[model samples]
Target chain A: MAGDKMLFVIVIGCGRLGANLASGMSAAGHSVVAVDSRQSAFDALDSRFSGYKIEGDATEFAVLQQAKTVSADLVVAVTDNDNVNLMAAQIAATVFKVPRVVARIEDPRKEDIYRALGIETICPATLAGRAFMASLESTPPKGAHNA
Target chain B: MNVLIVGGGKVVYFLCRAFISKGYSLTIVNRDSAECAWLARRLKAVIVHGDGTDLQILEECGAERCDAILAVTGHDQDNLAICQQARIRFNVQRTLAMVNDPDNEEVFRKLGVSAAFSTTRIITSLIEQRTGFEDIINLVPLEEGKVNLTEVVLRDISPVAGRALSDIALPENSLIAIVTRNGSPIIPRGGTVLAAGDRLVVITLPENMGRVIKLLTGGR
Candidate 1:
């Protein structure tokens, strides 16, 4: 949103959520490199969507390098496993020097640690509760946060 | 309009740029200073290093004075917390949240949020587009569906592909607004040729759906 050029993003994990975000971001005019160990992940991508794709474990440094994670301005770790996602975020932040890291932690309790570490984390359940409550106050859905 | 975003993740980046281009001020909040610097340097958005859910951070960032507040952190909980504080605690008038789950949209509306967008819902709609229905990929509901804006993808068999917009026998209450093709978006003109794979965004009433679909897909 900030640059004249598209933001360079690398998404770890090629599952349903990951592929959707990758394709959606690409549609939103961001440059993206999406990776996953399974070919099925790549298959779900829109045929017309143009971007980079690599097949390998996101946790492996070699795999990340191959996907050119170092050059990415932002890295999104949306893998199913919280530990792997945390590790991916660490790699993006500490190892690759990626400017920003956003990881999904399924467990809401882990958020405190994620925040303390300076990594942005999203906990689905708590966020949903706030949104549901906010909707009760307005006609159209309005955005509301808990903090 | 100036907007202060409560998070510095991908959605914030996308929305900030979009609103900024449409002439809106943008500020980003994140816990990481380096991330703040990087995001700020690129988007020219003001970056505040603090927790988005913190009342102090929102006030210090002057979020109350802004036109709109968008909380789109990876954590739905954080986004919800920030939006609520901005509303009830700080009294910020306009607020929006990203409802990570599609099933949560109705729930968000009940909470009084201005707008709630679910990535899951939008993605599913996109995936449903491949079904070969060229007339209207997704519809933007308006006034309880009294009038709606819809997108139509042009296919090879479309009867209106080569015809002028004015010549097409579109049902009353329907208007073609824009056409997006091959990644290039264009404002519609009367004589523009609709090519295969072109995505057309049209505004019309629900009653016109069948006619629109038939014309765009050359009815089976």
Candidate 2:
């Protein structure tokens, strides 16, 4: 951990996905700050996670400022709401000028908008569909005669 | 002028009617296909079915050629993104957004949205005005409520009622622009003497508004 450059990361939202990402990043020796509107969302993070937790709406500019997003090297917006994630990610990328910004959007159709803004997006629905299709393609169909 | 309106709701319907009546061309982009069809059937404007926050949808709606973009989505974040995209990407001259949260107004302004209106705050202020805070009635707030134009009514018991404009100490950066007595408007001057029932139109910073009100209303 001494030789590795610790990246300062701000993760907006503390849902299951957000919490897991925060904890993982923290475990990887990165400085992480997790933000959520509800204080209870922090419970999703494991006790071993030592990253900072901020209870506030990530869509707020002031809250982001309080989270020290201006100095953040990477910002991830994983809020359950697509609009909230998009707004937080855009603020990180465009307003705060963060070098790397990513948002989690449920609707895969919104990928174009995120792309146009030059923000990366992860859609669980699309990911799951592709994963299921890949698994199905790898396995032989049932009741098929041996070739 | 051509205008691109994003989202669908009562506000969109009313805006569509108003803009169409005024002979302005409108193109509405709504994610709800049913609402888009409803708007298409009722209004003469073109309807595009897609998420308004999507830049591709907005481009399909011809946002670049539009004179203005109105983002009135229920979600404040969506409205912010729509307005920002329209302004920065499409170069729309005017971008108006409906702010669901009053606290986000300054942030929207800082992000370069042409204007953001908080309906909740406006209604609250209207109710406050009706509650009759007699000393001063705020006429308008400009620059995110930093500067205000207010009407101050001078009562008979006011300390400055009989004082000349020069003698009465006004708050810093505050100016008495005009005076109305018995429905007659009078231009204010240094020698002008304030009287009971005189309505004064004052322009001042918001922080100094209270001091100006206290001085004019006899410290009430």
Candidate 3:
């Protein structure tokens, strides 16, 4: 892994998304570290990972210290709760002074909160509509006769 | 370019695998080390066992030089924070984030992210297509209402199943791009004929969906 110089990424959650992301990034030749509240979250990871793995509470300060985010190229928060993720971003910005930090916001209502916090956000609802529309475009209606 | 991933979801897995195939530099951040070991060994990407939302951990992971950052955790908040850190704090050139709520796409775009996607959206679209349309199995978007890619299966009820390409009048702005028989994809030509159980990939304008599907399958 050291042979190639690329971005270093850390994922906060070890749940479904966290595990999949870690495995995928590793496959892509990026250095990755995955963390989760529970050990079971790691079960989904592939056997031939391309990066290191750690199990711990991503919201805690001690866990962050162990992972060494101070010099990381990028940091990602994917925990289940929104508040914890926001706090994590605050810490990343205020304490560690990491150059980059990103957060996911599932609730469209809390978009303003995330934006006010100076963090980036992804809304799931809008994405759903877009995908639905896209699929509609490709899906021909039933019972239509075309040759 | 160096890429960073900040989630451990299914989409993240797919994204990571795609990057690996492209030979891009990659790094992953997660809370679990043991579970991620398999991926660690496969792509040889460095893994840090920690929270991505933490500033110190992100710094340690080297966010400054990353060319792109993607956040795809189960929680939308976490993905947002990772993208924020990568773009606002680290100054990463490109940032892609995942939204669990499809409604939040505008918010992501407004934040100046390079791109954003939601797994729920993709899955729902697939489900909707399968349930709402009997003849069409798959649909992919193209330009805004101008054209799209569709997958259709020919059944016994299809009127055009036994017809040659020249015999049927295709809907305006609609074209059959491919045909599959015996599970093998075949490029469609003028003389090609449609048969039962064959799958066709077609491109058509949005307004032509009703006409195209009706003419091809006879509207079962």
Q: Pick the lDDT winner.
A: 2
DockQ of each: 0.02, 0.31, 0.05
Off by over 4 Å in 3: A1-147, B9-22, B32-43, B54-64, B84-133, B139-147, B155-159, B166-173, B182-184, B205-211, B218-220
Model 2 residue A146 distance off true place after TM-score fit, in angstroms: 23
Question: How many pairs collide in each candidate, listed in order?
Answer: 46, 0, 141
Colliding pairs, model 2 = none
True contacts kept of each: 0.00, 0.37, 0.09
Over B1-220, each residue of candidate 3 has an lDDT whose tens digit, in order, gives 8998887745556778899888988888887776477567665677777888766677888999898887777766577667876776678888888776664454455545666676666797788655645668546555422467878888898988888998888867989999989979999787898999888888888788778888878873
Q: Relative to the true interface, what fraction of contacts does candidate 2 keep?
A: 0.37
Q: Could you give candidate 1's per-residue lDDT for residues B1-220 as a string of tens digits?
A: 8788877666667777887788788888899888887787779678899987766788889977887788887765466556766776567788888766553454445445577677887777777665644455665556533576777777788888877887887888888888888878999887887778888888878888678777777873
TM-score of chain B of each: 0.64, 0.79, 0.62
Model 3, position B146: C-alpha lDDT score: 45
Winner on TM-score between 2 and 3 is: 2
Q: On DockQ, who's better, 1 or 2?
A: 2
The DockQ-derived docking category for candidate 2 is: acceptable
What TM-score would each prediction reach against the true structure? 0.43, 0.71, 0.46
Tens-digit per-residue lDDT, A1-147, candidate 2 = 246889999999888999999999899889999999999999999865799999998876789999999999999999998889878887788778999999999878778768877899899999999999999998887757565
The segments of candidate 1 whose C-alpha lies over 4 angstroms from its true place after superposition are A1-147, B14-23, B130-136, B142-147, B151-220
Instruction: List the candidate numbers ranked by DockQ, top first.
Output: 2, 3, 1
- Find the 10 residues in a row with the least total lDDT in model 3 chain B: B137-146
Q: Write the per-residue lDDT of candidate 3 for residues A1-147, one digit (tens) a residue.
A: 345677788888766776787788778878788877778877878875667667776655667768887767667787777666675665665566776778765656556656766567666676897999999999877757553
